[model samples]
Target: MSLQLPDVVETYFAISNGGDLSQLASCFCSDATVFDENKTHEGLAAIEAWQHEVRQAFDFEVEPLQALQEQGQLTVLTHLAGNFPGSPIRLNQVFRLEDDRIRSLEITPC
Candidate 1:
């Protein structure tokens, strides 16, 4: 979709797709929060744990299909496929960035 995403956001997708836990955690601010699966994970420790659990539970890949930005927030539409139910689904990832790091992210089904 030719999305010119911010560096941090691009790094997020890259690390996530590669299943690199350390690199994924590095893309976020220390106090970053991630909202997914109807739960909130706060701080780098929590975010890392959440990412680890999810990655271990499902082998998934996210492909960015579209993107939109407003103020300091960027929302990307992504196609996710994995071994879980609904092997392929569209999702919207809303991210808020600060100082080149992801401050917060909320992912929801599209």
Candidate 2:
């Protein structure tokens, strides 16, 4: 399937797959937030730490299967596959953007 995502959102997924920690900072604003796995990560430093923790825990790749935008929020249906338990799973990634950067992101089960 083909889908078009906002520039920042596209870059987020690209960076996620690339696993380049340095480039990950480019996907979000300085004070960005991420809500995932019942934990909240605030600020760029926290987010980077969260990403690093997850990378060490699960070596996975995310693919955006579909995207929906409304009311300033973009929710993308993403598929993850890797060596983690279940092997593959789908998640709903809700992103709020600001000035071409991701202001916040929340990942929920889909």
Candidate 3:
């Protein structure tokens, strides 16, 4: 079944919290692109690879504080905390969904 933006976001949180790569891949479009402060990943292959790399680098949880849909984008404010001092990073996760999957994702530290 096709999922809404919120559903996709929730799935991402679940998969991330669980560190489940397979589950995480399900939420992205076949041609999805994800961008973070360091790098950009394109397509399902790159996204999955990047997910694996990120999961290994950080032990954290992305807790969504606010989620809203505006102008074809889903914007979320989240708190990220884990193996770092003052790590509870506040960030924005903005997503663009296409065909019920995430087509683009941009994360910015806030």
Candidate RMSDs in Å, in order, are: 1.2, 1.1, 3.8
User: lDDT per prediction?
Assistant: 0.89, 0.89, 0.82
Q: What ranges in model 1 sit over 4 Å off?
A: none
**In candidate 1, how many Å is residue 12 off?**
0.6
List, residue by residue over 2-110, the lDDT tens digit for candidate 1: 7888888888898788656788666999999999989999999998888888888889889999998888688999999989998799999999988889999999998
Which residue pairs clash in candidate 2? none
Candidate 3, residues 38-99: lDDT per residue as tens digits? Answer: 68998899988887877778788778888778899998888889885679899999999887
- Work out the TM-score per prediction: 0.93, 0.93, 0.87
Candidate 2 residue-wise lDDT, 8-63, digit = tens: 78878877786577876788999999999899999999998988888888778999
TM-score of 2: 0.93
Model 3, position 48, has a per-residue lDDT of 84
How many clashing residue pairs are found in candidate 3?
A: 0
Lowest-sum lDDT 10-residue window in model 1:
17-26
